[model samples]
Target: MTMTPSLPSFDLQIDRADLLEMERDVWNNASVPARLKIEDNMYDVYIRYRGSYTRALEKKSYHVEFEKPGIWNGASEVHLNAELFDPSHFRNKLSLDFIRDLGIHTPNSQHILLTRNGEPLGLYLQLESVDDTYLCKRNLPPGTIYYAVSDKANFSIKRKRGLTSGYQRKLGNMQDDHQLIHFIRSINTSPHEIPRLLNIENYLRWLAGAVCTMNNDGFTHNYALYLNSEDHLFSIIPWDYDATFGRKVNGDVMEYDYVSITGKTKNKLTTQLMKRSGYRRRYKGILEEILETKFNKNYLEDKVMDLHSSLRPYILMDPHIHSDIDSYDREPSFIFQFIEDRKAFLRRELKKL
Candidate 1:
């Protein structure tokens, strides 16, 4: 893999014991003073660079946009992963790039490498800070709601038991789907410059395509939904890509399982989502076109291969940690599973449509 001139040499040289101690120190006391502060009607926002279990050595931002950023961003906001895992393989930057290339909605980001003692320590993807002031000032219509996690919020509750446990909790809750459908219905009822329902469908299809492409760790607590004053709803912009691009180990090969698209209830909800007439008739073609154009197996293969190449050396130097990275493979069956299962659900739902 060709290395970018800007990227520093991949030379991580700390023993397992030393690494653990360092990790503890960093997690225990790794916070910086807030540069800017903003207050929206119901929330106080603070932004700070921090670390996480998923990406042990890196620094990323915590945005506290609400009193609580859900169960994930809890008071113990900064901590080391109980286990080590590779950060998203520059996944945020890659996802932003891939999404923009395919014409999807994403916040802007730039790549920066965080260092300690003037030596490269980890990579950070700096994103454009978005606050509710901007959302309110934009003049969104009544009943349109915008949601985000405040920096002080604890999202860890959702993931308390582990990744799967967190996902199950989210799936069992009707509130997510209820809120989502409510937004859709609001769009359907409201008068807007754009065809609101069509926009919603387009976003869903785009999100599905993104899942197929990256085999991403799909929407958990961090996904944000944005609604304009005009009652036009946009898809939730993806955040936290540290576990994307087929890099996860110990998972099923099926794309549906690659993320959290499992369980009978989620299956039913997914079926209902895809079965919507607007999604089935008007948006499926566009989704198919985009998938064919931007997210074929070859595309995913090339991208993953490139990422593996870039990160391979760093990973190899640490056998224990790198072994986890080596475990993931490009399984075509994953994509097929997603298509087949979603197709079956859609077919059943379409009969009613």
Candidate 2:
């Protein structure tokens, strides 16, 4: 007899209100000392707390990082919230994991579950913090940075325009010919002995192909690229996967094109990306390969189910995923309008190439 791996189990029917409440409880009661502290960095939430038995002895909590603050506090280990619960999001993580497992330079991560008051609240996948060393080690231009904007955080490109400094400067700008050249130049340089530009381009095209095949909403803000001091550039690891798996708009799959904002204006990067024959050709292959994968459907479905099973019980009592459902719903008209405008913008820009 052969033994099959037992699938992970979770609850998907929980309301959003319960999830939020649980999040609050965990925020309040996790074993952090009173002297421990938390600070919001605008980009991410940071927490300073008492180290665990293992961490205390090592005095290395300073080196320890979690994807989301306190996400690991009450759990046996830290993990990302999306990977443990949200089905669509989890599938995205699995896709990324598959990519990394296949030798891609994706950020490292592992699944984790969070509980509070002796009850399961939710799940998260903890990610290895990609240090500034990874960025600085590469030789990049003076002003190179990366960012990711998500619906949950309202960190879209449009929203980022008002922000200043760090990664924000990279946003809020339309793509132009000169900017395109600079972007290409930055990535093409040899950073830390790595073929920074080529690898970054390859990954972008690859991601585009994957997004199309999976019917994922690959918004420009959802992806990023970074430059290091070594004059090298690399693709920032991807995040957020809750809106994938055959999700479509207007009978057409949602394709992420950073070049166009609502199909009207072209981002500087998009113009350059379209001009690259190598990127276009590779994108074609990526889409084809994604569709051709032997277990594509099964893989996706199983991933969703696995995530559902792992988070169901805990999510049931949490309010974030279920209770406040109305808060999560976006007006379809607005999204469609943006898509239509962006498509038109891309069409015009593509013709320039």
Candidate 3:
């Protein structure tokens, strides 16, 4: 007997007035009170529009916050990503899992079906929020977390023209800004202090993951920095990876060689580290190891195929991305080709380092 796979469904019920207010100001951070029903359990939650440009899209992503703790697998908050930009709808989870395999912390994600006020919203990728609960789940020590909201989050002293800071503090007090400011200053002025202030090994692994996944937009933004309270060292976690795996953030098909093996150099930390032979050699070694193990044609093909098989049944039901159904079905081959070409490119580039 063959059993069909299914996804967990969430029914969100919001007041008509609240829903209208939310739709009126899509960019506002204010969340409207709502009720989320999962099977027989109904939870009090707050729902709001999530993502920058996604708020303007026909299909929208949402940020859901539970009024109480320990809801939905110990997550108090979750982001429901519409994944409108990716044809395959697998790159975000795949990239995060790949980074986790390399020993860097990443958000846990899964596919879920969402409905608002009895209207079907289709498939969404529910991503675990990086907060105190996330740390507790992994049994990590207390730390401060900041989201790299823009390119200015680059480890540089200069802020983009009018912006004050590129990062948004998710946890910790206002004093945490001083620590991040000091770290940025050190990155630009005191290169030798990097080892003491930053977790070099973890950063190297994260860098390697970003390079291998070809997340061109991940360098300065789309990541989280965790400042360990005990050691006062910052470690990065990958985020917003739907743009990875041979696809641009805008849903364009990216060239296999679009990103270099060394990754983006605009960031002061990465640029400074790459100039040092020791860090460069270590990064090269990490890239080599990943290529030999996880980034190969065989391993990635199986992964893409498995994801495709699981999502094929649901892809057609997703109104946002289903318009290009053929593209979704054929994405596995495209991704496999990207992997084969990228492995060769990285290997050749690694030798040059």
Candidate 4:
């Protein structure tokens, strides 16, 4: 016998025109008006497919933008993650939970029972989308330069390669690429000078977070960089975490200490910064603090178990389980084992510092 956990509900209503378009195989960049009802209240949302991998799924993830906004608990938009990768349907949840606990600039999320036009679409992770409103909600300056980077040259001398090639500008009014060019130049030319152009503590925490979670995809892509208008520094924000917690992009399995857990990254700036004596020490200290505090295996195990227990009953109700419901049902304990093992391995690995 198992008990299901309580979660929020979203009954989504998309018009037939949009529904028809969405059902097609090439619905990657399509959008439709969606009427979403949370309890008796309703909000008009512009819904569209928004992900590289998840775009190819039968049950896909979505980006929901509110046409009108006042900020509902700091969220101006939302994403419905289909949890296509992990059968336990908890990897993204666990990752977000870890990020929030680390006290970083990350989108808040929760498990929610989703219904499509009165029928169950299955369990989805309803995540708050990180955008301009996210900055405002945290009382951060609205003029921050935000980039949704999805390519290589990730924080490198992108200006040297081509200003238009590396990342997409989400906000801010840049007269030209000079600001980003200068930032990249500073990072490449003077690593010690980063404190003038970036927030050291924020950078340290972000690098530490990726290492702790073993987010293999986070270094160059799968991340958002915000040049804080107030502080005039760049900070990393986490995104797309189903590939973490013992998994790699090439289908390789990750063990504890799977990654270097240092600032050394494909991104030139991160690699250069980590080479510095002071930055390396600070990064090591942050890792130690994480291992001692929030990333403690026992604490994480409790969360994994709780998520699995609550979702067990609902997972049974899910029509799409990749292989079978039984295999899916057993994934919690498997991932839980990963969490415990990863922590143990890191402890032994980080004991040097």
Candidate 5:
């Protein structure tokens, strides 16, 4: 039997009035000052509600920024996800870890318990914020990061709002926007030159990860674009994946065949890439490799079982879960079925490709 790991708790001390103010306006990005106790030490931090749609949830996710840099685990800022939509609470972690294992850039994450004003909140998945700190921690060269916030983030000149960009620049100046826009224009006009501007292998690996996990929201949005300062190449990083693995972001169960093998085609990058025989062949090879290794039912069974074993007790203690304990217990089987069904689907699709 796998031993249950001792979960760390974050005790937050905040003013009731401020907390109420935040709760009243769920869309407000303003943060309130608070003191957080972790183990034996206490740190002053700024706490704010995080996520879209999740803010209205009874158990809210949070974004925590330390007053001082490198205070907690070398991260100046962190995102504590309530994972309200995921019954298993392990899908996001599993997906991110799998992407990282593919040698792609992905945010690190762990599960932790949370409390506010001495009142127990619930379990949360703590994610390292992707910023300059992320690059520093990985010993990578300085780069600019852009978050694909909306469907308009699809690489195209014409957008829904008549805007040229749908990304939030997380780590760059206005000049970076010009560079990114040029790259997007190139994707349409000069598809063959994409290999020079983008890291094709890394991007394909991330695509494979998204496809395997069945992250229906991952293609055009729910991901980050990192432009390396040294290589002048853009690479993708996975994000916001709780709505994956046979479930929608609204917690609705989805059939294993929900997302197609080619993934979402709303984005021109993927459409243009797949049109070429070379990129298609490469992507198929990546899918085959991952399916043979990590994405298969046999390979993922232990991961699912181990995560369920460690999280089941804590999940039972959580008061915010919408599903019953029996439903939570059955999630592993659902995930395994998804793995089997998705693998078979992809195999057939690969042959057709």
Candidate 6:
């Protein structure tokens, strides 16, 4: 085996063990403000337990926020994604790269080796958090309303859960919900009004990315919706792709284009939009274009191989907390097989449209 090329890495050290202990307590499921140092630079941060059930695991994903500006490349916070599901640990990174290649606005991420109290914790995927800082970095105007969709966020007129729990507020006040609520109602009831209230092109591209990658959990949840203050319309952004490529969120193998022929999602608003022949055809066209240009199997395989080779050394030394590392090689190979099989499956399915 050869040594992999060096990439940007972060070495983290925290001041308080008690705060970390609180974070690790599954029952507490809480966050504590603490001082953290990354590569000798210190900052104020809130370390919080994140993810639905992933919090229960020994290796838990984290929501980390830095209060000061210019903490890290102009980022206020980043998601420390604990890749607990697949041993290969490149599923989320690979999927993000694929989506970005397709021109969808997904979070930028990199592999980071983390440590606490100078001891190696394990490999973590550091992802840009989607919030005001994210919007500012993109040159998007301020006061943009950001809503994080989850499994329960069906965009239904009838409320299933609390009005607040379904969608998370990132940038603006709770009053901003009126616009989104009205928009969701309009989507379900007055389907024809969609083209006026939403950024259809961006949503379609994101949907296309999800379909090509077989992200079963992406549509209803694992996505962000941003309301461009200027136009008052919404845009969809991809999130939490750890279950992408070949499997559903629950670790089930899924067929490519698992949701719909034209890449329509399980999202209620998305379903309503796909009812139109024009949108359906447009989705087919978008998916075809992605398959031809960005989602190339050879390109993806090369990318995956580079990642596999690069991470091989780290994987050998990784004290991974929850996953079965014995299957590391097998998992990456399965992902490769998924790309080839998914590409073929999508090609065949695209022809049906």
By lDDT, who's the top model here? 3
lDDT of 1 by residue, 1-353 (tens): 55643432212223355445545555444333222111111222232324344334343234322233322222212211112343334455565567666665555554434333235444434453333332333343433323333321112222233212222221213444454444334433432412443355545654554554443444333344454435444444454444444445323233333443221223222344454565455555654555556555455556645654555565444334445553433223343344455444433443443
* Tens-digit lDDT track of model 4 for 1-353: 55455677888899887888877754557568888877677888888887776677777787887765534556777888888677667887788778868778787778788888998888898887667877877787765545555655366754445643556777766653566667777787766677788777877787778777788778777777777666667777788787777776533466756676562357676787767878777877878888888886567878887887788777777777634578667776667677677767767866554
Task: State the displacement of the C-alpha of residue 296, model 3, in Å, after optimal TM-score superposition.
Answer: 1.3
Comparing candidate 1 with candidate 4, which one achieves the higher lDDT?
4
lDDT of 6 by residue, 173-226 (tens): 868888777787788788888888899998888888888787777777778888
lDDT of 2 by residue, 1-353 (tens): 43333323222222455435434543232332111121212112223322122222211122223334443333222223333223232445655665554334454554544333334444445444333433333332343445444322122223333322123323224432233234434433422223334354545544543343342444444444444334444455554443443334222334435323222122323334445676555554444454345224444445545554554444444444555334223223233344344434444544443
Candidate 3: pairs in clash: none
* Candidates' RMSD to native: 10.8, 12.4, 1.6, 2.7, 1.5, 2.6
Task: Please report how far candidate 2 places residue 145 from its true position, in Å.
Answer: 5.6
What ranking of all candidate models by lDDT puts the best one first?
A: 3, 5, 6, 4, 1, 2
Among residues 3 or more apart in sequence or in different chains, the pairs in candidate 5 whose N, CA or C atoms overlap within 3 Å are none
Per-prediction TM-score: 0.51, 0.47, 0.96, 0.89, 0.96, 0.90
Write candidate 5's Cα lDDT for 297-349 as tens digits: 77778888888888888887888873467888989999988889888888888
Q: After TM-score superposition, what is the CA distance of residue 5 in candidate 5 from its true location, in Å?
A: 0.9
Q: Specify the poorest-scoring 10-residue window by lDDT in model 2.
A: 34-43
Whose lDDT is higher: candidate 4's or candidate 6's?
6
- How many pairs collide in each candidate, listed in order? 24, 51, 0, 1, 0, 0
Show the colliding residue pairs in model 4.
5-310
* Alpha-carbon deviation at 240 in model 2, angstroms: 2.1
Model 3 CA deviation exceeding 4 Å by range = 159-164
**Local accuracy of candidate 3 as per-residue lDDT tens digits, 1-353:** 53447888889999999999998999999999999988779889999999998789888999999995447788899999999889888899999998999999899998888888879888889999999999999999999999999988888776454222788999999888788878888888899999999999999999999988899999989999999998999999999999988999998988888998878877789899999999999998888899999997777777777788888778888766667889888888888888888889888888788
Cα-based lDDT at residue 298, candidate 5: 77
